[model samples]
Target: MLDIFRGLKSLIKISHIHIDSAVFRLHYSLTVILLIAFSLIVTTRQYVGNPIDCIHSKDLPEDVLNTYCWIHSTYTITAAYRKREGLEVPFPGVDNSKSYSETERKEYKYYQWVCFMLFLQAILFYTPRWLWKGWEGGKIHALMMDLDIGLCSEVEKKQKKKMLLDYLWENLRFHNWWAYRYYLCEVLALLNVIGQMFLMNRFFDGAFLTFGIDVLRFLESDQEDRVDPMIYVFPRMTKCTFYKYGVSGEVERHDAVCILPLNVVNEKIYVFLWFWFLFLGVLSFFTVLYRILIIFSPRTRVYLLRMRFRLVRRDAVETIVRRSKVGDWFLLYMLGENLDTVIYRDVMHELANKLASRHHHGVKGELQEA
Candidate 1:
């Protein structure tokens, strides 16, 4: 444990963490912001708005009120009834609360579960990034930070840039095996996006599971005064019944309406979230393919490097990448498809130049000293 802390301290001292890509932005930053904002909107609206409106016998007992609140927080069956001989009997009527078919309660009390589930989904999306960071051991961030800092150095004679690149490709010097951290992150990101499509369905409506195939596309917005128990993007208007039996063989009933103010926020947020995930999923798939292709194809890597560096010949890039010991992982790390080309072209150019210089100057014998 002590050794681990010392290593962590050294890692932090070496370089700061970098977010690295758009996939990261979606999983960590955007997911968190969306979850928190939606959750808060739901919660705050309930506190300030009339979320539950119960229509029942006035001046009811305290126990009945408690029961009404409890059932109102959950899903309750709604139906119609007609009064006969002082007894309320089930009968269909447009204004009567007693004639609707049985419906299951929502899986929430006051829509708390919706936000809770969304928050859980956010956590799920974040887990891959958390795992990647754990495996990174701070090396990726350190390399980028060191390179960025050194690239801006006023000391032209300093070898800090070269030393940093050497550190990045060190295993290449000894083991001939490249560290595959970046590819692993990309693969994990792709999986996270795919898994979320399934995982979120369990928490959300069937439309999400079916990619909106199972959703009802009706505009019943004008019927706010009526009980509409159909599912939509905003499920605000629902009704339930509360029953209480007195010890003296007397029974009373309360039919109440349940509303979630957060439904408004959820309606807009989920629509956006669904499309955003789809877009991100497709992008991640291509990224996975790109990583796999570059890792296996030397010519492809050389071609990309030629485009990236603009000066290195194909043979030169290939020999330097293979002989000077740049692994698929580190090379891709610098040439990541997601990296901003303009901001990072200088760093990659420097690396290409170093490899070319090393080969041109016949410096293989001095490799140990480097």
Candidate 2:
């Protein structure tokens, strides 16, 4: 048991001792820097804006205010706006005009939640790679090499083992990294799409219209009681219309009360879509760029090329040895002829001389023996 334990310890030590100084350290530093920067960016910006204000209240209708309230209660928005007129507003609901069912809303909400979960998952998935790279005895180089080769093989196994390693090494490296980052960005893009869709549908359906109607009603009701300052001007404006020869003329006065225009809702939806498209496009573009970089970069390209050459060389050598015993003399000759010209010439010359001497037999053999 002690001998077994001692052997295991020695193996572990040997396995760990072959670390790549340059690549490992560079990757470690980069991982640490990116993690710190990402964390700092998320953390320091957290409290800079009012959390309640982020979601546009104008995008929410009065009918489904309860749903909005529920969402807000769970996840805070950074900003909100209050309409000046006081009215009993029901919880904002889905616009009846659009006829969206409860099931659809639930599904949309669920999709949003899934997106959020994916974003969280992406962060979690990235954390381990960062942590592993940062750790002291992490064997990052071996991990990278394994990623490059697509499989782990014992170094000592030549022929068949080397062939397997070479095959894996060429095709796997870029694909693994691409799959990870692509999924992450894709999930984030989907989340943005869902959130934006919800906001646009909510705002345009009845939120702005309801707000507009409420304002118009308030103005009309106040005018009936002569409590409205604008009410007094109607008579004068009417008289001015009579005096202006069949045209209604009025004072060039504007209302001081700020009306939140419905156009703002349209603009909000436009901006949301624009940003959503832009972000997704950028993410996709970067993914493609990284893939190209992996393909074209000197180190990666050279590594892939070398792996391919090794595969070819191993296969050629194996084929020669396999057929040499079988009477495939023609195939063996072809292979030998195709080998590196200088090596082929030297090998052929040596073999030819040996065969000639063997046929000559006793004359050369007796001279050498004497």
Candidate 3:
């Protein structure tokens, strides 16, 4: 048990080198850990405590009645949510109506599967990271070439810088595929969040997509106009019909009021997730747009590099941006993030000078030939 918790703890540990963006990390690490934690909490409470208790007649065995109702399922009256509590009904979704048909009863099966669903969602959230890791295969880390460490000997530093620059020059204009793979991962993250919202709506019988919006409106609406979305979605009090043999060996219907303590925990968990997913969706949408800008606009790349390192001059940044394709620029951007600021600045300066001199020599030879 201790080992299990320790493993979960490791999921949130910060990595020394980051190959992905902040939003990407949030999707794979913090969001995954939170979902798993919620799943465990719900599973533990459902099994360790009395998840359901029903008020039944003295003649019926309490344990058997409770077990039967829990396993077969409990339901809420669809019309009761519209009725005022304490006046027309004892509790929201707990009506004593003889005219209610089976169709009027909305049986909740999601409560039983909540833990498993949550765990599955955690896996979905990590899928993009898994795909990206396989495709990335430590490319950035390999190119970093220990430039992250600034205390190396001067000779070693120069040699490493030359080797890195030579590779970048050789591989110029060939990195579009690599960079596009990462952008595809970002797009997948956005799609996953949107897809999960719809999945939860289906899981909750189509009440999840607008859950956060409904809650916000409920808070701002007048008291008389307010309807608790949480109660409507996860009713605490419900009804169950149990059948048994009576004194004359005839069948009898026993209506019992069941209190679901698990729903109380479930309501809070989903409310938090509703708002959290909305936030992630908005963030991821903009992240994709930002990536598009980076791909299409070379000037944006120049500005970003200059902003990231103030010491890197505008002309040098522009020269590098003009000479390199999107893939080379992306690789240099990532290296800037991982490498020491001073080392990155020096490398960029030297690479810019070499590329500029090569361009000058090519133009001079062309003029002489003419």
Each candidate: what lDDT? 0.54, 0.32, 0.90
**What TM-score against the true fold does each predicted structure earn?**
0.67, 0.21, 0.95
Candidate 2 lDDT by residue in tens digits, 1-370: 3443344333222232222222222222332333334333333333333211212234333324433432422210111011121332111111221233324331112211322332343354344334433442432233232323324344432333344334323332323343334334434444544453444336334232233334346566754232221111111011000011122455332111111122232233333334433454455456445445543454443343234334334333332322222212222232232333333333334433444454478577888999
**Model 2, 293: alpha-carbon shift in Å?**
20
Using TM-score as the measure, the top candidate is: 3
Ranking by TM-score: 3, 1, 2
CA lDDT, candidate 3, residue 314: 92
Evaluate model 2: give its lDDT. Answer: 0.32
Candidate achieving the largest lDDT: 3
Poorest lDDT segment (10 consecutive residues) of candidate 3: 1-10
Off by over 4 Å in 3: 1-7, 247-249
Q: Against the true structure, candidate 3 has what lDDT?
A: 0.90
The local lDDT score (0 to 100) that residue 28 gets in candidate 1 is 65
TM-score-wise, the better of 1 and 2 is 1
- Candidate 3 residue-wise lDDT, 1-370, digit = tens: 3455677876777867888999999999989999998898888888887889999999999999988988898888888887888898899888875878878888877888999999999999999999999998998898787889888999999898888888887888899898899999999999999999999999999999999899899899998768899988988988999999999999999999999999999999999999999999999999999999998999999989888889888999999999988888888888898998888899889989989999999999999999
User: What is the TM-score (0 to 1) of candidate 1?
Assistant: 0.67
